[model samples]
Target: MTRLGRIIQRFQSDQGGAALVEVAITVPLVLLLSAGVFEFSNILNTRLLLSAGVEDAARYMARCSDSTWNNCVALGKNLAVNGAVTGGSARVTGWTTAEITVGKTSTAAVDGSGTQLYLSSTGTVDVVQVSTALPYSGVVFWDFLGFGTIDITASHQERVVGW
Candidate 1:
């Protein structure tokens, strides 16, 4: 073969380390994809847990008298931790007694309300609002993605059923 033709043929025949190079390029991508999936799943799980906890507490306290409000808050914290537990870790570590807010309101904004504690209303028609503010950090892959801490809040309102 001529010089240029020989060079081209030799280059095409040199397949050494090609598989290694390909693997090197794809491994990181696969790892990143897997980490992202794990992170997203954790976040979704925590969100659902928070929602359930808030709703449960609100419903439970809705039927009780005002004297039992502390019980409602305590129950809310427990429910929140139970709901958020995964892989032996509580996703919402900020779920504490001080973070739980129990209040009475006259509006339907209970579901979308912030963590702020509204004044307790003594009226029979008032709705009890239970809310918690959770700090979310990705469990598996958050550091790899350079994501910062996220604050998620869950709130629910249930109308009083008894005096």
Candidate 2:
């Protein structure tokens, strides 16, 4: 047999190189998938935490507000901060400052349509809303995903029962 023919035969029979090539191709894909899952999970978890904080703030305002709404916004923001810091602590991890906005708005003003759903300028104020914006650039793959700093916003509203 010719030398080239023998070499060709050996190459065709070789299974070892095939496994190496397959691994080289598949390993990166596997790694990328794992990273994507981790990032997505982190995003979802953060959002849930923020949402819970907003809910707590809105509920408190709804039940507690009276003739005086003084510092009510501050109260809600503080409560939300506590929830964010405590709930997000996977082990001493917390944000020092989160963009939190708490305010009173009329049901009609936010009657389901507006750019700032939690805001009210006029009319009978009967709704308490807690809104928050968090910068989610801390995710492990956030940079890899090309999202410099995704701003995640969460808001919750509750009707003021007494006034």
Best by TM-score: 2
Model 2 TM-score on a 0 to 1 scale? 0.73
Shift of residue 58 alpha carbon in model 1, Å: 0.1
Q: Please, what is the whole-model Cα lDDT of each candidate in the order they appear? A: 0.69, 0.71
lDDT of 2 by residue, 88-163 (tens): 3331135333477777865664545544544556644588778877777855677876878887778998977644
**TM-score (all chains, Cα) for each model:** 0.69, 0.73
Could you tell me which 10 consecutive residues in candidate 2 have the lowest summed lDDT?
A: 84-93
Which residue pairs overlap in candidate 1's backbone? none
- State the lDDT at 92 in candidate 1: 56
Q: Where is model 1 poorest over a 10-residue stretch in terms of lDDT?
A: 82-91
